[model samples]
Target: MMRLELNLLIEGLHDFEKAKRLGSLSNEYCRESATIYLSQEDSSILGVSDGDIVEVSSKHGSVKVRARVRSDVRRGLAFMPPSPYSMALLGLDEHPSIIKVTVSKSSGEPTSLTTLFTS
Candidate 1:
């Protein structure tokens, strides 16, 4: 698998997530929150298709999330809402609006917020 450094932009909660009250542990909430949007170019480079699981890592930590190829995203960049998956990667030590992350295809399941705190 190929791993590439991509800039990850942490975004606000999606409408669905907001409706779910941000901390819901439902499967729908988990599926939405644990998704990473990538540019077509980036997806192609990583050989990832929509809904494919990918491992995103930083110096702080790593999290697995489903990938979504989006035309709105720019190459070398990724977008994900503020959720447990993204938070796991960012860690608790430092907070940056945007940061570089190593991304690659993964066979693991999407990470949940509970797992992050428990582990």
Candidate 2:
């Protein structure tokens, strides 16, 4: 599948309040996390729509999660709230903030955060 290089931004969202209060293991916390924000143009190019499952792969690893279409993010850019899903691709290391990843529509369901942290 075709891939693109995007300026990745892992930032806090409004749900930070709820996640902080509920704790990371809480369902509410997991529900409010790991959403990948992509521009409408980029989403279409990948043959995906909002809420579609997509696999984002870096040289390190890959994570399958839900895609979110947003005007807030410009083309060639993506935003994902910090969570276990992104952590799988990030691992535990001092890596560059900007990553070249392949984002493509996934044939399977969006991976759960539990599985992400596990195997």
Candidate 3:
């Protein structure tokens, strides 16, 4: 399998994320948090399409999330919402917002919030 290592930037609160913040347990928030935005070229290189499950691993650990292919993202960088899921990958990095991670297509289900911190 092809795996690409790139910088994963944890974006600040998005509008929808802020709106859903009150309902942290809402499915919408979870879905949004469990998504990773990848460049179209990167997605194609990994043989993954939008909504496909992908495993993103950092020195801290690995998490499976849905891939959102977007042309806005750069070829060697990925974007993710600031959530527990993103926190898990960051571990204790000083610059939590930006970290290196390995991304690859996966057939596994997205990691759940409950299991995110536990693992």
Candidate 4:
């Protein structure tokens, strides 16, 4: 796969229903929050499709997130919901809202958010 080097731009998006219906405890909820939105141009470059989980890594940290192929995002950039996964990536960078990340398809289910830092 031609993995893509992407700089993720955090938009601080919040989903009330995701929080209200499933609450924060559910892995599904965290997965939803951790989903990454990548532009079609970039997704094709990475050879990934929507819902395909990808590992996003930066200088500070890394996290796995489901890929959302979209044209709405700028090429060379992506968007992620504000969550522990995304925050972990942010912790590595001086800029709190954005981070440089490499995008690649994950072999299996993305790593769990709860155990991301621990195991």
RMSD of each: 2.0, 2.2, 1.6, 2.3
CA shift of 113, model 4, Å: 2.0
Q: Rate the local accuracy (lDDT) of all candidates.
A: 0.85, 0.75, 0.87, 0.78
lDDT of 2 by residue, 20-42 (tens): 57898787777567568899889
Using lDDT as the measure, the top candidate is 3
Cα lDDT of candidate 3 equals: 0.87
Which candidate should be chosen as best, given TM-score against the real structure?
3
lDDT of 1 by residue, 18-110 (tens): 736845777677778888999999999999999999999999889999999999889989988887777777755666668889999999788
Ten consecutive residues with minimal summed lDDT in candidate 3? Answer: 12-21
Candidate 3 on 1-89: residue-level lDDT in tens?
A: 99999899898547446746668788888888888999999999999999999999999888899999998889999998888878888
Clashes of 1: 0
Clashing pairs in 3: none
Clashing pairs in 2: none
Please provide TM-scores, in order, for all candidate models, with all chains considered together: 0.87, 0.82, 0.91, 0.84
By TM-score: ranked, best first: 3, 1, 4, 2
Q: TM-score for model 2?
A: 0.82
> In model 4, what is the error at residue 14, expressed in angstroms?
5.3
Candidate 1 global CA lDDT score: 0.85
**Which pairs clash (backbone N, Cα, C closer than 3 Å) in model 4?**
none
Q: Per-residue lDDT for 12-64 in model 4, tens only?
A: 55552456277776756776776889999988877888989899998778778
